[model samples]
Target: MKRFASITLRLLISGVLLVLLFREHDLFADIAPRFHSLLTNWHWTLAGMGFAFLSLFLASVRWHIILRGLVPSLPFPMVLQAELISAFFNISSVGVVGGDTYKIMALSRRLPGQTMPVSVSLVLDHLTGLISVAILFTACMLARSSQWNEIGYDMRMLITGYAMYVGGALVGLVISWFSFTPSLLAWGRRTFPRTMGNPKLTGLIARLTQVHAVFALLWRRTISAMAVSTAMHAAFFVSFYCGLRAVGGAAPVLDVLTSMPIVDAAASLPVSISGLGVRERTFEALLAGLAQVPEAVGVSASLAGWIFSLFWGVVGGILFLRAKHAAHIAPEAQCA
Candidate 1:
């Protein structure tokens, strides 16, 4: 019943977001014009692809670093495959929270005995990435406040509210990090057995402890992974800039680099499925005035980004599947 309710709500939200994204007739008319002009910017288009590939590779490195201690013998290529597969799942889901569960599952299947450690590595990777993104968005919001001021009151308020939310989230994360100890979970189990449910909650509590312990052992590596992830994020923003230029929008590259993360974070809301319509709507809403271009141009830029991501993600998926197949074959061949 609970699962059904959740799926039903997600479907409803997806429908609403799609409507919001496509309801603007003027926007669609602008897309053809924007696409026609932007298609000519082959240089920026290629640059975007390059940056995206670099970003993916860097993300793979981050994962490798995280797993180095736990699964030291695992090949970098295999880890890269996992990263790509994870990204593919994330894009496919388009929900607020996607990919991590799939990623953990994939890693567990591939690494066998290293499942628990790999899962811990992923948790640390995700936590640090989330913190970095929140910090980046907050910084970008503060830096771009002046430009937003020239736009209008509502825009300013929206940015302000978003900043506050990010700020709160960062603080909350810090607090949780400090408070997340084994004792806390034990207390929770005892205090709220009804809410906590059965063995699943108990298992989860044990997993959290194990994750924290593993994290302590790999803190240095985890930090290194986060640094690589940050670089990758920067590369992704640059890709978005190229996409903007491709669409004939003469937006400042720095502005896009600074603003893109927050734009993406906002679009991550459950408003649209797999970020379908939300991506277009977000670009239109934020970039239209700032770039001094038609909303259609912003929409085109967003679509271009989605295109680059999907293409690379597909490449990753092929590699991931190949690696998985090889892993399966290797043991069988040895036995034979």
Candidate 2:
């Protein structure tokens, strides 16, 4: 019954999302007629897509660095594979949960004896990445102060909410780090008392501390990771800049850069699966007053981003299936 209810809810969400997406825009007029223009602008789109994927790869590499401290002997390819697989699932209707779980399972399987530590590393990797995004986006907004003032109230609220959420996460991490043993142990015991009863489980829990140690040891590298991510994120903005240009729109690069993170973050609020309706509305609302671009153009650009994300998700699906099949066919040790 619970599974049925969950499925029903997701379907309902998808329906509402579709309505939201097509609500304001004339789907046939705004989207269908734009195909030729999009094709003509394919160069920018392809370039943007390439840069986006490259950024994701770089992120995976940074994640691997964090993982190394947890499971020193784990293969790099294994980590990358897991990340790709996870990212693929994350973009689907299952949302972030499916992807995160897939990632944890991959790490657990690949590192065998280091499951807990690897899990710890994944959490840390996610935390650091979110922090990195916040720092980079904040810098982008500050650099384009004038543009910041022009953003709508809805967007400002969204950005503020995201900032608070990330801030809260950082606070939680600090709290966890300082008082790691009791909170984590209690949580683990409550959730997995049977596992906690095993000696190996105690060792796994201890390994989590080792993972934290790894994070401390590599704290410096996190700066480098954020630096690289900043460059990549800038590259992402450039993609959008070129994309807008390709479509003959007049929005400035700085405007797009400053506005995008907030808009993107806002659309992620589960108001729409894959951010379909929500993204279009946010983009139109945010960009309409600031720039002379048509709502359709902004909507078109958002649609293009959705396309690219779905493409990657499709790739992830293939990997998910491949991993599933390999799990069954391969030796148990090979999974590790």
Candidate 3:
């Protein structure tokens, strides 16, 4: 029943976005011409795909670094495989949680006794990636503030709020690095003996303290991970720029840098399957409104970008299926 509800919601959101996207323009007429134009500049399309692949490689490397920090003996190849499998699930499933669950389960099976730390690492990895996105968005906004002054009030407010969010995240990371969460837990137990009498609550507090300690231990690695994440996201942005050029769109590189993050964030909201219509519409809006590109060109570039991602998702699907088969055969082989 829950699955049914989720699917229904996803379809509804996708339907609404599709309507919005095609309302002002002819879908077939607009996209077909731009796509045909892309064939003329096929080399740029290949370049975009290369950049997309590089971004995925960097993402796998960043995750491997985080996993290794938790389990020093964790092999890079294994981590990379797990990352690709997760990406497959993320693209194939209804939402991103499916991929995260797959990743945690895969790692937990491989490292039996360290599920808690593995889970913590995954959470930290996501948080750091989010922080990097926020930082990048803020930086780009500031860099183009002069040009953005004429943008709508809503956009200005959104940028300002995002800047505050990035600042808050940075401060939180610093506090967590120097925090005495363990001591705080101890003090809470001492001060609230009655409350601490509940084993479940006590256990929860203990786990939180442990997670916090691990997080602090990983502070240095988090910085490096964020740096890699920034590079990875930049590569993705460059890929989008290449797509725009391939489609003959004249959007500025900085405009793409600043706007793509917003479009990507909106598209990742779990409202539609793999962002689908949401991504196209957001891309169309940002590119047309901010960069003065044609809506058809913007949508075409977005579709091109999606095709690049779909190619990777297909690769990930093959890798995931292979991993599943290997896991299934391992015990049978041992018995034989």
Best by TM-score: 3
User: Once model 2 is optimally superposed onto the true structure by TM-score, how far is the C-alpha of residue 53 displaced, in angstroms?
Assistant: 1.0
Evaluate all candidate structures by whole-model CA lDDT and list the values in order.
Answer: 0.73, 0.69, 0.80
Winner on TM-score (2 vs 3): 3
Provide the lowest-lDDT 10-residue window in model 3: 176-185
Q: Which residue pairs in candidate 2 have backbone atoms (N, alpha carbon, C) closer than 3 angstroms, thus clashing?
A: none
- Candidate 3 lDDT, tens digit per residue, 72-119? 999888777777777778778875367779888888998999888888
Predicted structure 2: clash tally:
0
When 1 and 3 are scored with lDDT, the better candidate is 3
TM-score, ranked from best to worst:
3, 1, 2
lDDT of 3 at 62: 82
Report the lDDT of model 3 for residue 144. 87
Error of 3 at 273 (Å): 1.8
Give candidate 3's error at residue 263 in angstroms: 1.8
Residue pairs with backbone atoms closer than 3 Å in model 3 (clashes): none
Model 2 Cα lDDT, one tens digit per residue, 1-336: 766566566657767765766666777866667645667878876876776677667767777777665566767788767767776766775443667688887777656676666677776676666676677777766787765666667667766776687678778777767744556777878898898879986786676676566667778766666676666566655655555655556687667776676676766675446556676777766667556578888877766766665666678789879878877788876767
User: RMSD of each candidate?
Assistant: 3.9, 5.8, 2.8
